[model samples]
Target chain A: MSAQPAAVPHLEIDGVSKRFGETEVLRDVSITVPRGTFLALLGPSGCGKSTLLKIIAGLETQTGGHVRLDGEALDGMPAYRRDIGVVFQSYALFPHMSVKENVRFGLDMRRLDKAESAARVDEALELVKLGGYGSRMPSELSGGQQQRVAIARSLAIRPRLLLLDEPLSNLDAVLRKSVRVDIRELHDRVGTTTVMVTHDQEEAMSMADQVAVMAEGRVLQMGTPEAIYERPATRFVGGFVGSPPASLMKLSRRFEGGWRFGEIEWQMEPALARRLDAIRRIEVTIGLRPERMRLVEAGTEGALAAELRSSEYLGGERLLHAAVGQERIAALVGGHLSGLPKPGEPVHLLPDADAVMLFDAENGERLDP
Target chain B: MRSSTPLLFLLPAVALSAVVFLAPFAWLIYASFKTQGAGSLLMADGLTVKNYARLVADSYFAAAFVRTIGLSALTTLLTLVVGLPVARLIATGSGRAKGLLLALMLVPLVCGALLPSLGMIHLLGPLGVVNGTLKLLGLTTSSIKFLGTTGGVVLGLVQAFLPLMVLPLVNTLSRLPRDVEHAASSLGASPLRVWRRVILPLAMPGIVAGAVLVFSAAFTAFVTPQVLGQGKIATFGTVAYQQAALVLDWPFASTLAVVVLVAIGLALILSAQFDRLLRRRRLAA
Candidate 1:
């Protein structure tokens, strides 16, 4: 669309839509992945992230629109001919085939010569750090090993695009972190245009170069992980993309100089007040991220009166639960800090003014400054 | 103590089978070794190998044995080819279609072999639906021979035993995750190759199970062959029936029955060995 700007995108999804009987599973979703970029379609369950991945992989056909790779339209190409590899959540290894055989299957389909096929199988196994595990059956391996084998099998094909559907969801929590790092490293080494669908924000943030946050069959925002995290396009994106997600509080009537949040009328900076004046709506939602807010003395200026309810020690940081008016918000404090307020005691929460976000109360869309 | 309780729960079933099934089978085996006097139908002499000797010496019995084996094999293959799609439909299909297909499949089994075989008579008789349609269409001037033919008997047997193949196939095929097939296709295997490399190999256990059931059912089936064969075709079932009921040679008939049972046992053992060999082949490959 940009008149051959730079290199063509390795994978392009153009206004794709999918409908299953009466239910619309995906609606006008589109994204493009530059070659070698790892993109994660991040969303909660039933968000159509997996459906979009399946459409890209050619595992499922889209009801409307087109998907292209390297400027070539792949509308009617069968999955087998698309040269896209998919690693399913279950691993989906041929229980009958050994590790080497499973990896060699794609090569066999291409009718590659035996020696080269065997060599590629060995190369793939080595890449996944399962070099000596060729003889082992899938059932014989642990969950982590099986997942690695699945990745190896997909990589052995040397596909133009690689799709993973919640690859680490089936693993136990302990193995998930290591596998997550391994997948990112593998993507880097292989340099294939890869798309991974996951609900785990940490996995998406740590692994993918670009993250697309989706909800209710539509993509809300698509950008670099930092961009999505720092400047979320919608209130849902703000609440969905972070650990201890940003808390949203309703804003009341505007006072003499600033708006009222909860029971307290907090004064706003002149620059921030000017931005709020742009929106004509009386009702607005303010987003305060837990990490961006801190505890201050009860009588501190420009701070909301709150009561400390509980604290959760998380190794290096402690998450404190505070109640202000009818709303409850959390703040992360240093674990080493001593003499924190006891539960039921009144405290003050001072949010970083620069980091504060405002959203339209009616539609949940972020109101950009 | 844990084992004893299971045995205790199994006692009635084992005892019932021992009384009703094992006792009759034992008697049949015993009778196969006994022979009647030359003039009387009643047993007169001690145990001997003459019935078995007579069996080995008879070319007619040998021909019947070969025919029955061929028929059973053909029936098994046909049922597999036909039942596979239907079983897949049942396994993957949802709601009323699956329930209806399963219920339809069970109709033959529930109706008993005799009823279906009797129904087959009207379908495959000289003036049956097929021949009548052929004649009415002017494809033939006269009715084509169906009764007392191998093809007719095979048809009847297939209709009767198809559910045997489908039930196990559905059980196994349904247990297969849809992901593996999707994975195969995404990994560059064509639809045909997916079936060859993934689906069929995985469904081998079901295929073996279904084949054993169908093959054994077809091999020892009586009513279908008797009613459809119309006395011209002499399968093991029909021949045994003839010797037992018409000729009234109980010892010789028992001998035939014993041989059929042994053949079924041998088939089961061979299939079990085949399963082991298949596992070994997969491992070694």
Candidate 2:
């Protein structure tokens, strides 16, 4: 995630920066991915995640940085000289070439023996579960099949590093789920240093061993998927990771005994209050996971009171959205629950103290626990 | 799904083709079969193969036929050689730059044939800028006489039809997704290999369109060959013009016209097969 400085890491990216004219797409980013690790660069569009992957793949030149593959400098090495594999978002299969021809291209480029190339192409196709699809043109195949062909085409050369750029974005939700597993399986079988860039957090969490969350030309945080989910380094990371997302309660001033959100107050521990006293009049933001916030009976003691606004049935569970003062908060209630909040009804919500996440009100930086 | 016969909608186009193209072409074909009756008359009852026989027996017509195909093929090749890279550059350019590049490419199309033919003459003719500059540099003393050469006509034709090549090429190459090239390059294919193994094969349709357009333009060319050839280099078009105007041999002229038209038609039809053949060769390699 960060600079591991291991005994020759697989891929070492040192302070890479990319600038196009006046705009800086990536600013001074560095990371060391261990050998045989699956890393995901997770970010929204325009966050420079794709650019970073392209740089690693040598498809793009970094404005200023050094990249090393197993401790060898990548400078002055053209794309053809670098042993890298890239699966583009569009699947970029050659429409004119048959799947076998497409897969054999890397072998032809390397000028490998004809017999060897054929065997590798067959093996790569079979690895992607596209064994009999060798003779079909890319246009004749479905989207999923084309994606697998692209994967096979890259893997045929036995690349030193594999980069996938939003590889499953083009597939439907149902297809995406299957292809995601295929990618993970392919990674497990190849055991190469793989870097994938995707906008979907669920995809990164499920597929990658290490996830680097990027924003505004910077890596906000890089950690194990569990670490990223349980303890996000920044408020953006916290808000971006979870579905139905976390609810933010804005507190301008802290009372003598408790944290106050307008008229609502939650009593604070002495040690916790002492730790939070460093900040003055500036607002404090508390992030509570929606699932961790339970809906209780109205007028319950030590609970935040809110008026129910709406309820949505989500097949597995129903979600209740309620208004606390001017802000809106949502909570999921499991099926077969006894009581459900109805619109215009008063509801009480309780947040676990240990599950509360604190962040700076303005900058969105996570305050230490 | 509830529509009437589709031929009903196509009847207007069919009628137009029959009146404008089919009728005239049929008459031209019919006239090409007749033999000379008297001094300057064409007789319909002869129904002879004499005109076609003349085209085969006479080396003058044979050379003209070869010249037409050769020059047309050369022009198409030269245009693709010069245009593919420029079109690729234009395709990769930003939106505004793309518009500007397209406008610049369209200059020849907008100005018509006369301007470029004249420009070619002024640039490459005997006393033109090219020879003049060469003379001043002490490279040569006399006129280069490019005015009546096949090279001059080919250059003139390329100028006339280059925009045709660029238009479809830019359209096709721009619509092509760039990720394939990236994938190829990342997979360790050199730039040349990427172009040959990926870009070129993928761009075959555009190449065919550009080649056909440029070939047809150069093959049927009259003014450029008339002005540039200056009666020295004879093509099917120039020979047909001469047979019709000077000798007043209508039958032979029709014969030359039909042969050139059929050759063009064959080239267009065979180009699809040529594309498939090229694909097969690449796959084998």
Top-TM-score candidate index = 1
lDDT by residue (tens digit), candidate 1, A74-159: 98889999899899999999999999999999999999999999999999999999999999888889999999999999999999
Best by lDDT: 1
The residue-by-residue lDDT of candidate 2 on B1-285, one tens digit each, is 437678688999999999998999998999999976786465657588899998999999998889898998999999999899889989889979888988989888888777888888889977789999999999999878788888888888877888888878888888888888888888887898888877887788888988988898889888789888888989878889999898888989999989878888988888878978876754543
Candidate number achieving the greatest DockQ relative to the actual structure: 1
- In order, what lDDT does every prediction score? 0.90, 0.85
- TM-scores, all models, native as reference: 0.95, 0.91
Task: Return the number of clashes found in candidate 1.
Answer: 0
DockQ of 1: 0.73
Candidate 1 lDDT, tens digit per residue, B1-285?
A: 887998999999999999998999999999999998789988867999999999889999999999999999999999999999999999999999999999999999898999998888898888899889898899999887878899999999999999999999999999999999999999999989998999899999999999999999999998989888988888999999999999999999999999999999999999999999999877776
DockQ of each candidate's interface versus the true one?
Answer: 0.73, 0.54
The TM-scores, chain A only, for the candidates as listed are 0.95, 0.93
What C-alpha lDDT, on a 0 to 100 scale, does residue A228 get in candidate 2? Answer: 91
